[model samples]
Target: MRKRAKKHNYTVIIERIREMVRENGLQPGDRLPPERVLAAAFHVSRGSLRQALQALAERHIVESRQGQGTYLLADFDSVLPGDAILEKVSEHDNVLHDIFEFRRIIEPEIAALAAQRANVATLNQLKVLVYDQQRALFNNNEVDQFDTQFHQLLVAMTGNSVIAQVMQAIQAIVDTSRAPWLQSRKRRQMSIEGHLRIIDALEKKESDGARRAMQQHLAAVEQFIFDNQ
Candidate 1:
């Protein structure tokens, strides 16, 4: 029953809502602003806003509870773009190696920048993500999403829009690369330790230490992948 003409507008609106969520620090289970307020913020009609929310609900990105507002059910990339290409690349035999190499080259620098540029708010957000990662690991639950969020948050803290968008584009590939390794508790614990080290360095504003922590973390990931293969 949806109109084809509104599809493009709906997608744009969806991305805007995602941006709002990120900018506002709305985590999973966090309620969004009221419908009229959101519509006003986005400069769209209430009807159009409802349409976009409905689309997001369909993807399980947001859920509307009775007598309450819509809440985030998952992270931003829960519904990634370019699914066809993502699937093709993720299935490639060397994808994990490629992702590891890419992260090694980029993420240490991101950590270093985060050390230099992160304000208290940014550091606090990173801390929240680290604890989220730990909780996920302790529960023996899936950590791929939290793992991806941790890395993506690092990239975002760099205050570089280009880097953030580029990382976002390839996040699904990175998630695929991380999935197999996180299946082992030992590997997950190693990752958690590495993230803690990075956080410590960032909290102290030690650029070199942050960079070193990230490098060590990625090296461990590379070693794990090498041994498993």
Candidate 2:
């Protein structure tokens, strides 16, 4: 029974370990002490301690290299925020702004391309995302993932895999920005409306209209970010 509860204790152990790492400015490739030593430090059994290490390993925070030992895999900034709490990547805030500018550059054109090239099937996929987003909002649930789905689908509609790949990379950067822009009901409503307008423009195959709608939507997003800040 004692052993059984230790499985659940990994989260706590990992939590403390992450806090220490942040305090010490631990870097990538840094090796933690062996499991037994960690167990002794934390006053937890070796079995429980190994479980904590394994959990971090799964998150790309730590890596095991067979003979050498476990190594820290996450960058210093990346590891600061553990799984339970998200933090702003303060070091890359300017990069994030640049990323949004990149969005401004790439997104409007993708929307125009979508208007021209999106097949009925691709449009239906966008519709599905909108529907899921609406359902989440109605249920008072978070719409972040669903919201991202709409943009991701729009990028795909460009019929250019390269655009999709670049958009995906941008999405990853956006995800790391810490303060979620979609946690509020008001934001979700605005996003849904924006999506609807974009979809309407795409459905009509009006390139200019689609481009305008996409640019308007992104402008609104930037305003919302500023308003919230």
Candidate 3:
């Protein structure tokens, strides 16, 4: 059908856009090429390009400003390759429990690694993300995207490709679940506070502190979700 074909085309366009980001070495907050330029380069109609952009926008991977061009909002590297781990697992499985347990086990080590490896630029970027999340909360906007960005950034700071791949799988699994849990302003504020503590530990390059902070944060998160559910 024509509709199916159009959908396929746009999906192709979206992957092409992701490839463009990789080829260009684009970073968070980097402005993408103008819409016209992108459409021309990809040999797609402007309408098709817009559809691709809209899909990215809904994922909070990118954002468009009124006068300014669209910009990358999160690291596209967080996208998993092929079918995600969750996709292969049974739907009736205790997937959420497995994910949280994995987080509690692995993420503390990630935080410690990040603390050992954090540089001035990485710290500055983390601060900016936290600030943006705070601003979003105050403005009554959803903070789940920022939350994702913050955690992804921490993973990036570790500079471990294997860890990156693992986090990407976890990200794919939780992408659908974040918004509902984050809808509560109290939850969002708590998340920000947890991020600050982790940031502080990273700034001091305290691996033990970072590990403890991450453990506490994950515990708090798991407890909150359990209480709510």
lDDT of each: 0.75, 0.71, 0.77
Give the CA lDDT, 0 to 100, for residue 130 in model 3: 98
Candidate 1's clash total is 0
lDDT of 3 by residue, 1-229 (tens): 1111112455677778888988999999899999999989999877657756765676677898989999998876575443232232223124555667677788899999999999999999999999999998999986778988998999999999999998797677765445452236666888899999999999999999999999998888766644443
Any runs in candidate 2 off by more than 4 Å, and if so which? 1-93, 177-182
Clashing pairs in 2: none
| lDDT (10s digit) by residue, model 1, range 1-229 | 2111212344556768888988988898899999899888888866557756765675677898988988988876755553422233223435556677778898899999989988899788878887888888888777767777888888888999999998888877777667542246777788888999999999999999999999999999767644533
Better lDDT candidate (1, 3): 3
Better of 2 and 3 by lDDT: 3
Candidate 1: global Cα-lDDT? 0.75
What is candidate 2's lDDT per residue for 102-189, written digit by digit as tens?
6778788989999999788988899899999899889977777888778878877888988777767667775543234223566678
Worst 10 residues of 3 by lDDT: 84-93
TM-score, cand. 2: 0.58
Winning candidate number (lDDT):
3
